[model samples]
Target: MSETQKLETQISDMRREKNARPFTLAIASGKGGTGKTTLATALAEAAGMGVTLRDCDVEEPNAHLFVQPHWSRHTEQNRPVPRIDAQRCSACGKCAELCQFNAIAVAGGRAMVFAELCHSCQGCRRICPEGAISDENMPMGSLDCGMQLKDPAAPINFISGKLAIGQVMAPPLIRAVKNVGAAEPLNILDCPPGTSCPMITAVRGSDFVILVTEPTPFGLNDLELAVETVRQLGLPFGVIINRADSGDSRVHDYCRTRGINIALEIPWKRSIAEAYSRGDSLCEKGAPAKPALPQLSATWPTTVSVPTAMLMPPICT
Candidate 1:
């Protein structure tokens, strides 16, 4: 087995033998407008057991709209951007050469670093012979966590990573968001759309993934890409066909052919759209989607390979 697969196998063994952490689920979509956030919020509301709904869509987080969490804890997330001291150094171009992101350059007899381009690897600082490079804090985003509902039986903890208005360093901010005290028994990660770095970061440590998609050609096309992404990471995942009736039966056919599980099918309705527009969650008391949530949470995990530690990055500061 490959390294990732071997890690996955060990994780499964640990989960079964050591009873490590509770199951974590990430709701993601191939493309936007696939009802991913909608399902994620509903699942968190209904999963109970003090589940945390982490909105990992740092770039444009909308889970907060549906979660309607009462804010209690908030903190800024920062990344290190280089500060080049021109006075201390000859333009030897060492920092530029060491920067893996090409964020630094020595041009026109001066050294320059692009704040946005820097990955904060600190390699430039480490490699600088003249000690001319230093790190400065750059705000990438913020983290917020609180309760979703007042009821004790199903009180939900909500956490979100909100990226700065124009910043692109979503991965680091996402890493910061994961630093919260997510002691809840269950957690649902509402991942960003697509299979990019941000989305991967959001879903990294999830035990199982719910790939939400519409029933259109566009949805299927992107869903294939997302499937490849998750499979590449050796993550076990299934599909959810949102607006199942809007498009043809291609999605179902595709899943069946691939032996992929279809966990839930949410047919589109005008009322559902209306509730969403009003910032109301699907599993609200009188909402139409309330009755099926428990089943939704229970159905997919029947065939899971447990893990010891989740697919997490290095612990954040």
Candidate 2:
């Protein structure tokens, strides 16, 4: 079989694995406004039963806006922040020296932990020789879980992570969101934009990554960086060009030269853009429905089947 066919077969096998870890697919973009969330929510809605949609864009999660999950459970998420016991500290600056993020600093016999800078790695606690460092859970964010609030019978479990205002740590919260809902057969992670730590954290365990981008120069530029990021992580990925009909073919050229597969292309349409502006999913009835999105589902393993109505035909691809 060709490499593409081989990859599809491998992904199919993963999806069919009984009682194993869920087959994860992360939808990401190199820059904002590339429609990553739109595509993600569409797939999640189309996948129907036995699927979990995780909006891992903790900093500014918007997938919830589209899925409208009626949150049955809300939980506050906290990360460990080092609390130094001054009485036990010798002012030797061990914690400061050991901390890579500069989260801890020692001076004048006082060690202060910068809660926002801490990555919750707990390295300071492990490195403290005098047992001066203790861990305190610092409120970082919140997670909400529920089924489709608008339609309880939609058969989708939605989980979203929202970083508390003024909280700089996002990877921790994203990881927390991912930790839940592993038992589901299929998972769709809507990762944060850009190839940063938060994005990497969300995309880490995904079986496949769908990189969404536009045909514009800005889109092509960031897409290259995103492609590099995913490639370095040694993950299988494909590109989805939004507004495919409007811009030049630089993105296409780049992908062709790199031997990258363009999985699907969503054309630019006034009706589609307007529907998206009103927060409508392409899989929904209100969106400019056309034919079934075979180009996308074709990339899926044969074992996995999305309903024809759910996989609405709105775009050329």
Candidate 3:
């Protein structure tokens, strides 16, 4: 059998197995405006109860808008930034020189630090000859927790990361958001768009990934990059084409030729767009995406024996 066919068979087998550990599903995209959030929200709703949805798009997290979860806890996220104490030492420029991010600069017989550019690496603090540099907690963002208000008793635990406006670092906040307790049977992470640091942080430990994309040139171009990223990370993943019928068939052809499984497809629909504008899940009343949610959330093995392991069930034929 072809590689793609074998992978498809394993996916089917995973759905039949009953695994105990909650599966972590990361819904990611290569670029924006691809209806990634819409599908992620709908899948969470379809998975029904016992699900935890973490919005890892700290910069533009909007999953909460659709879910409208009743917030229980809101905590500000902070990270340590190096601070230079003038009274203790000279303007040796050591801190500025060691700051690889150009966050600090010493000139005109003075030293200045740009908090926004700082990565909190603490190299400045350690390299300071006179111990003039110390650490200060800088507010990076906030982490909020709640439950779906619609069904409070069986509400999906909702955790969202919002990076402070103008904040450069999101990985820390993403980590904080994921650190929240998840007792649900399934954890769905709405990953940030693009294959950047934030996206990697969100999908770092996921069991499976759903790559959402359109079928246009832009989508196909970015999808290849995203597919490479997940493959490099050694995570089992599948593709879903949004507005499948609207664009050309390059995406389909690429998937077929490359042996990638097109897990689900959502055709062009005005209602889905309208519903999304209204902050709705677009999963109402026999939606096409509803049927695929079960397979998306199926019990998939978390670990593969090797980095070269292709998509296949270890315990199933």
Clashing pairs in 1: 11-307, 11-308, 205-311
Separately for all candidates shown, the number of backbone clashes (residues 3 or more apart, or on different chains) is 3, 3, 0
Q: What is the TM-score of each candidate against the true structure?
A: 0.84, 0.87, 0.78
lDDT of 3 by residue, 106-139 (tens): 8877678888888777888998888988889999
Worst 10 residues of 1 by lDDT: 308-317
* Top model number, lDDT: 2
Q: What lDDT tens digits, residue by residue, belong to model 2 across residues 1-317?
A: 99988867765564455236566788998988899898988887776557789999999999988888778899998899999888999888888998889988887778988888899999989988899888899999999998884444547798999999999899999998998754677788999998989989999967778899999999999999999998899877788899888889999999899877787788888988888888888877857533334567565432122322122222223
Candidate 1 vs candidate 2: the lDDT winner is: 2
Candidate 3: where is the Cα deviation over 4 Å? 1-22, 87-98, 106-111, 126-132, 149-154, 295-317
Residue 139 of model 3 has an lDDT of 94
Candidate 3 worst ten-residue window by lDDT? 308-317
Return the lDDT, model 2, position 48: 52
Query: On TM-score, who's better, 1 or 2?
Result: 2
Point to the candidate with the largest TM-score: 2
